[model samples]
Target chain A: MASITLDTVGKIYPGGTRAVGDVSIDIADGEFIVLVGPSGCGKSTLLRMIAGLESISEGTVRIGDRVVNDVEPADRDIAMVFQNYALYPHMSVRDNLAYGLKNRRTPRAEIDRRVAEAAVILQIGPYLDRKPRALSGGQRQRVAMGRAIVREPAAFLFDEPLSNLDAKLRVTMRLEIKELQRRLRTTSIYVTHDQLEAMTLADRLVVLNAGRIEQIGTPLEVYRKPASTFVAGFIGSPAMNLISRRAVPHLPVAAQAGTIGIRPEDLSVAPDGPIEMEVLAVEELGAQRLVHGQTGGERLTVAMPSDAPLSDRLRLSYRLGSLHLFHPETGRRID
Target chain B: MIENRPGLTLLAHLVLMAGVAIVALPVWVAFVASTHTATDFMSGTIPVWPGPHLVENYARMLDAGVSTSGTPPVGTMMLNSLVMALLIACGKIAISITSAFAIVYFRFPLRQLAFWCIFITLMLPVEVRIVPTFQVVADLGLLNSYAGLSIPLIASATATFLFRQVFLTIPDELTEAARIDGAGPMKFFRDILLPLSRTNIAALFVILFIYGWNQYLWPLLITTSSDYYTVVAGIKRMADAVDGLPQWHLVMATAMLAMLPPVAVVIGMQRLFVKGLVETEK
Candidate 1:
């Protein structure tokens, strides 16, 4: 296991288009760092650069104290699990696991031992001789993970590895990945566009926007105290509501603050409250209901109990000290 | 086809049977004629049934060839044709697959230009460039040799382009995965790309084998000695006999023998050929 450090990393394509710029993060040994953002946010590109699949355009990537800016992917001692799994279609699960070791000229007994161990760990021993095409998606996924595990590399890079699975399988695989990482304790950098996946899997979350780091902190820390309006809006489902200060002039916020942020759960129905919201629509999500409405010409959504009372118009009160303030011009959080 | 109409199915079967008969008639006639002596054709109407001379006529062609034309035995010509076909098919596949690999995977100056140059050769077949090609072969002292017969036809743009298409359909992720697995280019080619394209190679081999086997003009042009004669070219030479009428019985037997190998190749790899042509599931 090893720590990875990206120092002011940047990526500029040959066509003069910048994919990622001025990004840096320190990932501790055995810690899981998830780079999460929307599509085109360079999350995958950043992971690929660290994996040495793509060349770093600028800055140095240090893995276990060695700068790997020009290292080949094989020499970099990093294993990657791609979104598509990338298993060799022609190879059986056993051979697939052994291929990297075989290429490195690992001894026959040692390679066999490692491959067998990985198969046991992945519970794929039963399917060792079966080709990848014979396996189901989840089985193939395990084989892909087995390919990485047998390498015993310094770090593991995952690029949305669970995105191909169905929702239930994704949850199953997500838990399995977390458990596997915990057991192995390898330094891992995972990239995904799913905020929930990032939140559940990350030791520290690096939320990105437009190819730049929006904020980097533990999941709860970033969720509770978003450093920017983008983070506040993106890190949570039924995303934190950010409205213009003018939209809610009645709220007790600093006059200098230009925008107000409130988590959907922070708002409660109150008979006599400051903000009057006109009910628009309600989404039924079994245990909880999302109430989307307009208050003072700005859109706001509230997460309420499914049993909560509702009406055409209702007064809403936010918990004290729950308000998040930001600059309207820059959208940066105001402490 | 999906509707399962009985009447339409009957019509389809009738048309298909008609087509089969139309194509198989000449081959049937050739097979029947091979069983007869030269006097059988002299009587006028062609023999529709086998004659007692089948074994005698075939044995003569296989052992002594066409005595009048001074060609080698049918067995020798068949062996020569086998060598030439194997060389051309194997050589073409080897060169084209590697060129396609280089074209698809590597980055270098004039890579596109190199590919286009190979692609343009498809328009200039051996027939079009026969004079210059033959001159180059003669200058290199390859005439009347197996190298002369096969090497000139080895550089196939069709096979190269076909391989390029096959390689392109392979997902890019496989390449990235192989790189991460520490496989160099040739290792990746051998272990991954080659195995994945197994069916395609089989399909192309069948095609190129038949193509090489049926070659008449190129083999006829370069090989003047009877020792280097391919069966297909030798048949034409036997027919254009300088002395009397060509020995029809021996000639027919040679044609039958020449047709066997290609037909056998097709039959042997039919399943793989169909799979390669239709499905690229990987």
Candidate 2:
């Protein structure tokens, strides 16, 4: 296991298109870091740069003590799992798993042993002789992971590896990958546009926007204390509700000048509260109800327990501590 | 499905059957002509059916050259044709596959220019440059030899184009995975690219084999005597006899013998040919 350090890493394409700005991040040894962002946010590009698949235009990437900016990908001692599984369709599952070791000139018997061990760990033993085209999507994903695992590299780089599976299968594979990482404790850097995956899978989430890192923190830390309006709006499901209030009583006056952020879960129905809202729509999730409505010319959403009853005219209260305040001009969090 | 449209289905079948007949007609005629004697063929008295004269015609062609002239036998010409065709096919395929792999997988200086240069050769057919090519071969001291016959005609633009298009269809992620798996360029090409391109390789092999087998002009111009003549050139010479009247029987037999290897290759690799064409389009 090894730590990865990106010191002012930047990728500026030809014609002066900056795909990644001066971004510096230090991932501890055996840390699971998720780089999460929307499309065109440069998360995948950063991941590729880390894997030595793409050249860094500026700054250095150090893996374990070596500056690998000029190193070949094959010499970097890292294994990558791609979103499409990227299994060699022509090879059998056993061959796919054994390919890396074979390339390193590992003995045939040892390659066989590692292949068997990986297959058992991935529960893909029965499919050892099957081509990737013949296997199911989940099985193919396992083979992709098996291929990486058999290499025993210093770090694992995953580029949305579970994105291609079905929704139910994606959850299972996500948990499997997490447990596998825990068991192996290899430093890993995963890139994805899905916030849920990032939140659930990462020990630390690195949220990026417009090629710049917006915030880096633990899942709970980022969720609870977003550094900017972007992180506040991007982190939660159904998204956090933002509104312009003339004055929120508990908020500082400086924070009141801009947009106030309140998560859907942070708002609740109360007979008496600060603001009155009209319940325009209600979605009945199994455990909670998402109340979508308008409050004083601003759209607002509140999540209530499924058992709660809503009136046409509802008053909602938000915990002051849970409120996120951001400056309108800079989008930086104020309170 | 059967009840949907009977007349249209019947028309489609009829059209397909007619196409098959048109394609098979020449082969049938060649086979029938190979079995007949020159006298019987010229008189048009022989029926269009299999005959016992097949062995006689073969024995005549094989022994006629031996008895009439103190020259190299027909078997030697057949062997020369086989060697030339094999070398050209193998050499062209090797060059095409390697160059295509490099262009597709590796990043190098002036790659696009190199690819375009190779691709432009497809537009310049051998017939267009036969004279200059002959001069070059003579200047290189390679004339009147197997190298002259094979090397100039062996370099293929069509195979390179075919392989490049096929290689483009392979997902880049597979290459990335291979690289991250500690595979160098040579290992990746050998283990991944080559195996995945088997269909394209098979298709190009058949095409280049046929082109090499049927080559007439270059071999005719380069070789000074019957000893080095390919089957096509040899058959052409046989067709033009000393009396100025064509030897129809021996020409047909030699042509028939020449067609066998390529026809066999096509039949054996038909599946790969279809798949490779589809992949190239993709």
Candidate 3:
């Protein structure tokens, strides 16, 4: 129920390696913020810093009004759900939910009431007496969630909590986490490398690259307008086709811009289109087919309807004003 | 290995039976010898069959013991042995687990150096450093005491390394989750680590109890008094009478008593021992 503010936070290892640097993000109260990146992008490290698990090498982390830079994780009053669920294997679901509360010296009756409430909320009532190992993967995940919510802490920190579940289960749990966050209205920070999970779950997405903040906006906002070349390719699936300006030399805009980015969905087949493509391969994805091909010595992928007619060579045109331009020397966006 | 040939199965059973006989024969002989009178052994033919004086010989050893060797009663020696075994087993587990926890979880100055120091002690058993160990125990005035019998044997590098491997397999997420759950280091150890290690502790307990029970030389060297003599050491003393032939029947009875507790421990913890060795939950 508290807002979190990270002011130029950084993590520098004792051996002089930098994991995360100058990362500043402000999350509104009860907001679901996902730190999204590829592996080794420092999203997990930033989340750990916020959770007080990792020491903050610089900058201030304020949860609510208190500065928690020097505070121990236990004293920071936050609960974390780890990537593997991290349930105490020997404890029953009931005990796992009650552990944090009991550690905080919550009254016995209160602990029971909270555990029961969480069990019913998560539909884990039947599993109250079973050890974690006896439960299925989804059930263990729910118990991990139960452990966090029962604490009634200031915030919830999730380090890719749904990553360990199977793909189908990940979708279901992703929805459940969103629904749970909405119901409880607890400020949560989730870290993940799966862009799809990040897009579906986050109220706002924080895109990180190479230990620095690349972009921060609502999922659609970041998707529609990426601040840099990294986010342009990372945020969308069939990743936004990025090609060098020379690949489309006929276009007058190519003379000024070094890189041109166009999303897959924005491209359509037209007889009067400006760019000519040679068909390389096509991927059938149920309702939609991905047409991968070469155009002017550049690889391109286009998302088209499944029933669309195909040819060996086709002219492709992008939707109006959908083009993204980036600087040649630096990959930053150009207005 | 999975073949169901009857001839191979029969051969396997025969080999297993022969192996069991090779191991169990001496134990059977000891039991049969304990049932007979001293006069039977003096006849120069050791009896394979049980004698009629089984209860009488056992009761004499339990009550009066072998008086010629000046050792305590077999009952008293058994009690001392049980105390020493329990102390050593429990103490080793406690110290090893905590040290392993420190080695695995905490980051401190020269932490690896500290672990290597503990690891290197594996090369130095009490047998290797007996003189200095004995001197330390003597200077601390722990000789002829239960502490002297168990303390030198309690610092087990094998048990510490065993626990270190167990702790290493536990995910770092568990530790972080426990920390965020408001548990301090000691609280996490008690609530999470201790319970997760239950089967391993049971397994180690079985092994260390037998080790403590079978210690003959250290206990023999340290305790000059009969009150502190463990059953294993006492049995050796009972066999080493200078004046006359050893009391064969009574000595055999004491040997039988000495083997009981370790056998019970192994039998009781066999399931846990197998689980600890073969399976890990996390």
Which candidate should be chosen as best, given DockQ against the real structure?
Answer: 1
Query: What is candidate 1's lDDT per residue for B102-138, written digit by digit as tens?
Result: 9999998999899999989999999999999999999
Instruction: Look at candidate 1 and tell me the lDDT of residue B181.
Output: 96
Give residue A144's lDDT in candidate 1 (0 to 100): 94
Docking class of 1: high
lDDT of 1: 0.93
Q: Estimate, for each residue in B127-182, the C-alpha lDDT of model 3 and write its tens digit.
A: 99999999999999999999999999999899999999999989888888888888
Q: Give candidate 2 misplaced runs (Cα > 4 Å).
A: A247-257, B1-4, B44-46, B63-74, B279-282
- Of candidates 3 and 1, the better by lDDT: 1
After aligning candidate 2 to the native by TM-score, how far in Å is the CA of A89 from where it should be?
2.0
Candidate 2 lDDT over residue span A31-69, tens digit each: 999999999999999999999989899999999999999
- TM for candidate 1 is 0.99
**Fnat scores for every prediction:** 0.84, 0.89, 0.92
Candidates ranked by TM-score: 1, 3, 2
Question: Model 3 off-target regions past 4 Å?
Answer: none
**Root-mean-square deviation of each candidate, in angstroms?**
1.0, 2.6, 1.5
Evaluated on CA atoms against the true complex, candidate 1 attains a DockQ of 0.88
